[model samples]
Target chain A: MMLIDTLAQGLLLGGLYALFAAGLSLVFGIIRLVNLAHGDLIILGAYLILTVTTITGLHPFVAVLLAASLMFGLGWLLQTHLLNRVLGADILPPLLVTFGLSVVIQNGLLSGFTADSRKLAAGAIEAQSVDLAVVTLGVMPLLTFASAVAVIFALNRLFYRTALGRAFRATSDDAVTAELMGIGPQRIFAGATGIALAVATIAALYLGTRANFDPSIGPARLLYAFEAVIIGGLGSLWGTLGGGIVIGMAQALGASVNPERQILSGHVAFVVVLLLRPRGLFPRASD
Target chain B: MTPSRPLGLIAAFAALAVLYALPAIAPRALVQDLFGVLTLLVLALNWNTLAGFAGLVSVGQQAFVGIGAYAMFAAIILMDLNPLVGVLIGGLAAAAFALPMAFFAFRLNGAYFAIGTWVVADIARLGISQWKALGGGTGTSLPKGTAKDMAFVDRIKAALDVSSAAAADALTYWLMLTLAVAMLVAGHVFLRSRMGLGLQAIRDNETAARSVGVDPVRLKALVFLLTAFGTGLCGALAFIQITRVTPDAAFSVIDWTAFVIFITVIGGIGTLPGPIVGAVIFYALQRLLADYGTIYLIVLGCLGIAVMLFARRGLWGVFTGRTGIDLLPLTHRPPKSAAPQPQASRRTA
Candidate 1:
């Protein structure tokens, strides 16, 4: 029963990890550019939500809706105006530029929030729980997991079933060829980033409610997201969820053995997965 | 032949002499400031060697820096070794650690490789933080006895006519100055060597270089280890100056990797003189704007982004492009008279 409960908790925790990584995987898939600032952008979304909730006295979910739309526009403008210029043969420019952006976002938050950790007021939902046949699960974790599944499903449907998804696939396959075929790669990239940021806003909602966050936490979050993305395999959304679960389980199991080993266990799992499957568990067939 | 080579050498030596004599006349604070600058210069050179020449952009260099600091602390606290020797131990430990990390990181390409290094560094930090003997996450300070008994502290105190603390500062500054000069000379010499040519070829195109019998993996691994060694030395020197070792401070990506990358990119990548120019500019900026706190970092990030987007070649690149001067030439250019002779002979033959 104890082991089953631990596994259940781990799988639920993986849901949150998947949320953090979904935006990262989405952006990487569309543009072949890894934004080092992806984690910072998530935190930015969280802060935006916090601000909305504070100003409007609305529910956090409502605040997320507002933050998501705002972030989408911000993402679109960022890609169109800035990221597009740096995208090319050399990978250094995009990576460094994003790193610079990461620094900027982090410090900007620091200046505004003064490095104090903040959490969202989620009311009764924060302490609610659900009972299964063998174990109990927190309502927040269950919601996070459910949301992760919905987000992934929606993203997959959009990619395979929607015209915009077709554009993304075509653009990802070959930007120049897609452009020649009347698909504007620039616009596609902007849309992709916008969508990614919208997903980031959802991740932020859970992040703010589930745990405390500060300006400095973004990079550490980025580490976990990157690990999950890699473990799932690059460019594979489902793989990302699997990767997150693996890490979550590892951390949970490590904590069962020794509390101090929790984080280290997740990192060790990442390295082990990397060593065993360099391309990840479900690397994109195209890649 | 370029007329600048001989003049450059003379100027370099003269600058070294000036730096050597600086502690004698300069205030203690200024010496400490220059020490910080020189430490950063060493780090920039190491980063430049890896990213600029070898095409390996690692944001996890703090892994080595942190390891080096902890290694030094262990030597001082547990092994009861001289701090000077601990510096060397720290460097070797970092290099040894790099071997395994490179095996994992090298399997990754481009941006994945960058993040892979960061993950490794984070893992190291977490692991190191568990060792309660080293004060865990809270960290530890070098014992007062160790500081008082550091190598050459007495000699420096007598020579500088100063107290023990001032003498220690002077000693550290001189050690950093020597290491900085050595790194510059060594970097220049390495880049002019055959391996440097292979590394550059690999950077341009890995598969093409491999076809030409240049082992990209071997060259990259070698450079990675070498840079780790130098970075470890810098980390040890930095911690020695502070006489304290904390996991957070030692493994700080912002201080170690981000600033170094910014300096390298903003000065110029893929050039010998670029890091030096970049380091000077960075030190100047820090001195000027450090009082503003987070604003200074924001300005740095903004400047880094601006430079990457608008001036990719950086300040040194612009300077060399406009003036057509190569003070430290890594590429050999035959004389005008000698250049046509080979082509003419080949045509006639």
Candidate 2:
């Protein structure tokens, strides 16, 4: 019964990881550029939601809609103005630029937020939980998991059933050919980044509501997202969810055994996965 | 790039002389600052070799540094070895660690390699923190009088006729200087060699390079091991001055890797003298704006991004383009009379 409860908790936590990774995977899949600032941008989104909630005294759930739009604009601007110029055959420029952006966002948030851990108050919802037959789960975690699923499902629909998704797939497959067909790859990239950041905003809402967050936590979160993406395979969204669950389960189990090993166990799991299957469990991309 | 002029070589040795003798006449403060600058230069050079020439943009260099520092601490505190030997052991230990690291990270190409290395570094930091003998998470320091008792402190004290502390400072500064100069010269020689040509070829087009008998994996792994040794040596030597060893400080990606990456990018990624120019500018920036909290890093990050977007070649590349003069040119040129056009001999180079 105890082990069952731990697995349930792990599975719930994996939902948040999936949310964290969904935007990252989407952006990487489309642009072929891994934004190192993905985690920091999520942190920035949380800060935006916090500021909006504080200034307007609106519920965080309501504030998040405005924050997500704001993040989408910022992401669009960032891609068009900065990231687009650096994208090229040489991978160093994009990687380094994103890394620099990560540092800048982290420190910029530090100056603004002053390193204090902040959380969003959700009233009674914060204390609410549901008792399943096997275990009791927090309402927030359950909601977060549901959001993750919805976000992934929506992204899947957007990828397959929409003209923008066709543009994205065409551009990702061969930018030159896409451009020959009158689709601007840069515009597609900007759209992808904007959507990714909007998804990140959803992740940020859950992040701020669930636990205390500060500027310095971004890099660790980035590492976790990277691990999730890698473990799930590069282009597989469902595989990313599986990767997140693997990490969350390993972490929960490790914490049950020894508190210090929680994070290490997740990393160890990543290495183990890599050792067994270098291409990840469900590799959708041939590359 | 212009042909290397003998006069530039003469000027370089002259500059090296001034740098070495500065500890004797200049204020101790300046020497210490230069020591710090030189530390960054060494790290930037090693990083350039990986990211610039070999196309291995590893973000987990702090792993080698942290491992080196910890190994040095263990050597001194637990094994009771001399600090100098510990520094050597630190480099060797880091290189040994790199062997396994290469085995793992080499599986990932391009940007994935960068994140792969960062993960390995985090694992190293966590693993090292569990060592109870080395003070674990909180970290430990060198014993009292450890610096004073280091080899040649007595000799440096007698020669310089300075206090033991200053002598110790001079000794460490001299070791770091030697390492820095050695790396610069060795880097030049290595990059100019056939193997260096092969490495660059791999970077430019791995398929073509392999088609032409260049072994990408072997060369990349070798570069990885060598850079790890260099980084580890720098780490061990750096901690000797810091006199402390904590997992947080030793494994600080921001201080060790991020800063080094910025220095490399903002200078010139593939150029030898780029890090030197970048370090000078970085040192100046630090001195000017360090008073403002977090602003210095903000500026660095901004500059790095700006360089990436607008000036991929960086300041050194811009300088070389404008002047047509490379202080240490990597290109080989035949005599002007021997060729109708300069582009003729550029293929092999």
Candidate 3:
């Protein structure tokens, strides 16, 4: 019964990881560019929410939409103007460019926010809980998990069932061929980055409500998100969720024995997965 | 005709001599700060070797830096070794650890490869936080007695303590400068060798390079180890200068690695002087805008985006490609008469 509770909690925690990894997975899947700034951008979204809430006195839910929309615009412009230029066969340019962006974002936040930690006010919903036959779970955690599932489902549907998704996959497979198909690679890339920022906004919503965050915490978040993406396998949304669960489980179990080991446990699980299955647990057939 | 690449060498030496002589004429604080900046330059150069030339984008270089620092601390505190020797010992310790890590991290490609490096770093942080001898979360300081001994010996038994700080600072600056030059030269030589060519070939196209008999795996692994070694050395050097080491200080991804990435990007990747250019620019920025805090970060982000968009080849590449300035002589040029511009253009198109 205790083990079941641990597993349940771990699975719920995995939902957050999945949320973090989804944006990263999408961006990497489409452009093969690992946005080192992804985690920082999520934190920036959280700050945006905090700003909206403080200014308008709106509910957190409404603030999220505002933040998401703002971030989406930022992402679109960034890709259209900046990142599109560096997308190429050589990986160094993208990595170096993103790495530089990460620094700029972190420092920008520090200067703007004064390095003080902030949290989103979620009211009663934060403490609400649901009890199962064997264990109890937080309502927020459950919602997070459900959101992860919905996101993966929606993304899958979009990728396979929509024209935009086809463009994304086609561009991923062969940018030149997609260009020949009259699909503007630049526009597709901008759309992809915008979508990624939307996902980042979702991750930021949970992240702000879940814990107190300062400007400096983004790199660690990026590390965890990256690990989850790698563990789940690149280019698979459901696989990313699975990878998140593995990490969340490892962290929770490690915390159960020793609180300090929580972060370490997630990292350990990632290494173990890498050693045993270098291609990840569910790598795409084509990849 | 063989190009006049040696002119670049003369210019570099002249620059180095000027930098080395700044301590004689500049303010004391500025001289000390230059020493600090030079240490950062060492790290930037090391990272450029792996990521720039070899095409391995690692986000977790702090792992080796932390390991090297801890090793330096242990060597000085436990074995009672000289601080200078401790830096070398720290580097060796990092290299020893990196060998096994490379075996595992080398298996993944692209994004996976990058994440694999961070995983190793996180694991190292966890282990360090648990170990009691290493001071766990509280962190440990270098023995004051050792520092005092080194200082006193170098002071020639001065009548007062005035010579102590100066001697210690000068020794550290000279040691750091020597090591930085040595590593830069070593890196330059390595990149010019057959192994370096193999690494560059792999970066261009792994499959194509493999088809051409260049062993991609071996080259990647070798570059990874080389990067680890240089990082370890820089970590140890930094540790000695500070006279203390902490898990957070050693492992904090922000202090050194991010700056290097910024430097490499701003300077130019795949060019020898790029990292050096980047270091100078970053140090200048930090000095000028240290008070702006978050605004500085926003500016950095904006600048990064700007650089990526406007100069895809980075500051050095864009400026030099257009102006034909070879400060470090990393590129070769065909004779003006023999330059086949049309053929190159056709191939690219």
Judging by lDDT against the true structure, name the best candidate. 2
Q: lDDT (CA) for every model shown? A: 0.89, 0.90, 0.80
Q: Could you tell which candidate, 1 or 3, scores higher by lDDT? A: 1
Please rank every candidate by lDDT, starting with the best.
2, 1, 3
Q: Of 2 and 3, which scores higher on lDDT? A: 2
For model 2, residues B1-349, the per-residue Cα lDDT tens digits are 4345577788889989999998788888888899889998999999999999999999999998998888898899999999999999899999999998999888887888998999999999988888889998899999987878899999989988899988888888999999999999999999989999899989889999999999999999999999999999999998888889999899999989999999998998899999988999999999999789899999999999999988888899887776666776676666789976756223222
Cα TM-score per model:
0.97, 0.97, 0.92
Off by over 4 Å in 3: B1-15, B18-27, B151-162, B205-208, B322-349
lDDT of 3 by residue, B227-262 (tens): 788889888887777887778889877676766667
Which residue window of length 10 is worst by lDDT in model 2 chain B?
Answer: B340-349
Q: Can you write out model 2's per-residue Cα lDDT over A195-229, one digit (the tens) per residue?
A: 99999999999999999999999888888888888
Instruction: List model 1 lDDT by residue over B158-199, tens digit each.
Output: 988888888888888888888887887898888878888788
* lDDT by residue (tens digit), candidate 1, A97-156: 999999999999999988999998899999999887789899999999999999999999
Better of 2 and 3 by TM-score: 2
Which of candidates 1 and 2 is the stronger one according to TM-score? 2
